[model samples]
Target: MSNSVPMTVEGHRRLQEELKTLIRVERPKVVQDIAEARSHGDLSENAEYDAAKERQGFVEGRIQELNDKIARAQVIDPATIKSDKIVFGATVTVFDVDTEKEATYQIVGEDEADIKHGKISITSPVGKALIGHQVDEEVRIVVPSGVRVYEITRISYT
Candidate 1:
């Protein structure tokens, strides 16, 4: 579909696992909970019934969301990619021009973006600036603090 979303292979697999768990475990448990709540007599004043219905709604909504995401996911494997220039799923080591420090980051899809883990979204300021650039290329990115420069020292797909 035109609305497809890029997702790393690992991220796609994790999503699939969550979906499976929801369907196999969460769904059945919610159903059982609702059934037990209904047996408590008088659904009008039963807090357990209300709570179970709310949980059911949440589970159903989450299931639909996960299904949609999985269906539209464009799984990309980083290990299979090869390029001289920066591209999605590329793990790049860089040197900060202003701070004289070094850091490494992986250009990844939005769903897999985790700055704490060194995985950045392709649409992020630094990621956008680094794309299509090769080693030793200086990339300038404007963030909330200020403009920061980075020199691409290395690029690896694995």
Candidate 2:
């Protein structure tokens, strides 16, 4: 069985915007660049032509990838998600048992996860460990630093 491609509504909108920009703006610009480069003659010796072709290929590939992802995306709004248990789109506050440090992270999709922003992908080790757990539950997750225990202090949708 294949896993669902879970994504927040915002993340999905971002992807859609990116796809639109690539198709409407970037694609046309690259095509124009290629045409202008071709006018220089001698395609084999033209550096601009080569660069433009490479860039065009890259843009097309990215567009295809984004389209595929959007097609399979399961957009979920955080505010609409209601559950006491930890799940995707849940903002969970965890207290480190060993370090006595508290940290909050929003469980997000792979495309939207930014560690610097305290957003973690649902597929991550800690996220996986927290899933299906409720507030006050102690979870032990195996990380590169070794096994660490964290108590879920709070869970919020927003």
Q: Candidates' lDDT values, in order?
A: 0.92, 0.94
Candidate 1: pairs in clash: none
Residues 1-158, candidate 2, lDDT per residue (tens digit)? 23468999989999999999999999999999999999999999999999999999999999998988898899999998889999899999999999999999999999999999999999999888999999999999999899999999999997
Candidate 1 Cα outliers beyond 4 Å, as residue runs? none
**Model 2, residue 39: C-alpha shift (Å):** 1.1
Which structure among the candidates has the greatest lDDT?
Answer: 2
Q: What stretches of model 2 exceed 4 Å from their correct place? A: 1-3
Q: How do all models score by TM-score?
A: 0.89, 0.95
